[model samples]
Target chain A: MVKVVRNVVCPFCGTLCDDLEILVEDNHIVGTRHACRIGNAKFMHFEGAVRYTEPLMRENKKDDFKKVDYETAIEETARLLTEAALPLIYGWSATECHAHMYGVELAELVGAVIDNTASV
Target chain B: MQDVGYPVCTLGEVKNRADVVIYWGSNPMHAHPRHMSRYSVFARGFFRERGREDRTLIVVDPRETDSAKLADIHLQVEPHKDYELISAMRAVLKGFELQTDKVAGVPADLIYEAVEICKNAQFGQLYFAMGVTMTRGKHRNIDNAISLVIDLNAYTKFGLMPMRGHYNVNGFNQVLTWVTGYPFGVDFSRGYPRYNPGETTANDLLQRGETDMMLNIASDPGAHFPQKAVQHMAKIPLVCIDPHETPTTQLANIIIPPAIAGVEVEGTAYRMDGVPIQLRKVIDPPEGVLPDREILKMLIKKVKEML
Candidate 1:
């Protein structure tokens, strides 16, 4: 059965249109109503082949990434951040507010320079 | 506008009462497809009963964009001349005659007519985007535009708003301001938050290779940043957390995929007009995939332990 969810806010763009009706069937998005072409594309094409579903890691810039567990990924990330002299935390425009709060906390903990898309 | 102060209002006010709508250097027809129909031009409101018929649309752009085509009057200004155009509008609003026949490639007569339309409006709105902010003058153009709106207030009601990009960009600013007392380019290096735009901003720091590691959340700087910044980002250790595979993700040393916000995860996002709205989750994310907040929280905890 397709469940119709009304008043769904679009994640794409700053308009944040909150009157969309999303049709979901078996955990898959089927259709969207009252969304623009961009919003509709965002909702419909979320689970495409291009989407990354698992954590990945690479030792060098030129090396291909290998699939890793969340714990290992987080540990490596923490090690890198803790070891670095100056770290930059950027890109908070696409996510939610709670995520931004955590980002700020992490930046504070690591004494990193925090910024958003507003600068550029 | 730190000096002159900006006169602005909610999109609700624009929808209800704006009679003269100006799109200066913004192509909403393409960038914001439903903005006109939903809020500004076609939306029927309490006072705007006739909707588009009741409003006069004016588009000021160097190129004839689709939005310009729909405007009642399209002022084709010269590129990187928005500051001059705004200055001319301000001067004309103050009852001063232009020394030149044309200002910023727009005729002086058209400027006078546009000023007349704006001066006579019950409620006027000016919406601008990258066309002005990313141009040669940058924030100076915005500052001048704000001054023009302030000048228009002497004759009538006028409000201005930036056509902000990104769904939660304003939310980030609001959150950062309330939490750390700074909007963006905040440095926590001294164990406290400090803001200095030119010195601490992301682009400036990255271009100067001041940062050794980068933690990128939901935005793609590789696709949008300057070549120098991207080059530095490529040379450093990048940890990217995003749902989609973007250019930034390709440059990451650790790619942690998160559930799509406002899709698989319910959260709060601020609209362009600084209105906070709740985003609903319509579907479940892939197995074991977490939201950005969850992943960020875990990282924070792990980093705290390491420190």
Candidate 2:
């Protein structure tokens, strides 16, 4: 069955043109309208990239990202972050406000240097 | 104040109604590709049926950029002399004589011509960028731009807007102002909001080696920062949260893949002009992956447990 969604906002840019219309078929966005070039590119982001379906971990300075279980990988990641004396948390440009709020808390606990893409 | 500053309008209003559009240091073609098409010259509007014809385009920059090529008046000002140029314009607007043969790269005659254009416009808007903010004088340049707009308002309706890069940089500033009672690049390590752009800025901290660990979210300092700052980032324990692989991610100790904002997640982001817009989710994220909000929540929970 086909579905028509209305009043979709393109969050790629700050313009946030809220006139995007998406046509979905079989759980896929088959058609889009009123979106800019970047917006359309964002919609088709996964079409041409090799997706990382499994969790990856690297213990040494090698390009060896062993496929680890999700919990194991996350735990290790958390351990590395918590152990660091000064950790810089950047790249919040694409994240949501909810994530940014949580990020503030995490940075405070670790006393880490939290910065977004804007610093660059 | 809606955090940083309020009473801002979208670029849409500027294109449709503004008779004068000033591009001060912003190369919109490289940064905002759609800005010129949708909000500046090409877009057909009510009063501006002949888009480019109805509006006056002024490109004030240090170089003859691609945007400058499309401008009616291109003021190729000297790099980092934005304060002097703006001060000169203000002085001319206030009926004062320029003491020097030149201010920036433009002559006194050109400065007066620019001021006359600004003062005579029915509605004028200044859209500036990092070129003004990252130069030698920094915030002082911004002060001049703002004060010039104030002076222009004496004759006509005039406004100014910073061409914020990220979609949510103004959002960050807004949130910071609410939480810490300050604007962008604010530091709370001193138990209060302390904002000093160069001193507390990311580049200076990384250069001086004051920061030990760095957590970089959705940003890539390695690509844009100076060599010294990039070197510091490479040596630090960096945590990168982004969808794409970047130079910063290559050196990161923990690389967290986040659900793309506005696509797989929903949130609020402030526009360049301080307008808050809602980002709606269109689809689910990767099977095992979480949105940035969810990832942060998980990290926060783990950190609290450790504490």
In every candidate, what fraction of the native interface contacts is reproduced? 0.91, 0.39
**After superposing candidate 1, which stretches have Cα over 4 Å from the reference?**
A46-49
lDDT of 1 by residue, B1-307 (tens): 4557777699999999999999988898888888998889988988999999999999999999999999999999999999999999999889899999999999999999999999999999999998998888888888899988988888899999888789999999989998998889999998989888778899999999999999998999999999999999999999999887889999999999999889999999999899999998888899999999988888888988988
Q: Flag regions of model 2 displaced more than 4 Å.
A: A1-7, A21-32, A46-55, B1-7, B40-51, B99-102, B188-193
Interface RMSD of each: 0.8, 2.5
**Model 1 chain B poorest ten-residue lDDT run:** B1-10
| DockQ by candidate, in order | 0.87, 0.45
Which candidate number would show the highest lDDT if scored against the true structure?
A: 1
lDDT of 1 by residue, A1-120 (tens): 998998889988887887999998999889999999988998887545399899999999899999999999999999999998989999999999999998888999999999999877
Angstrom error of the Cα, residue B30, model 1: value is 1.0
TM-score of each: 0.97, 0.88
Docking class for candidate 1: high
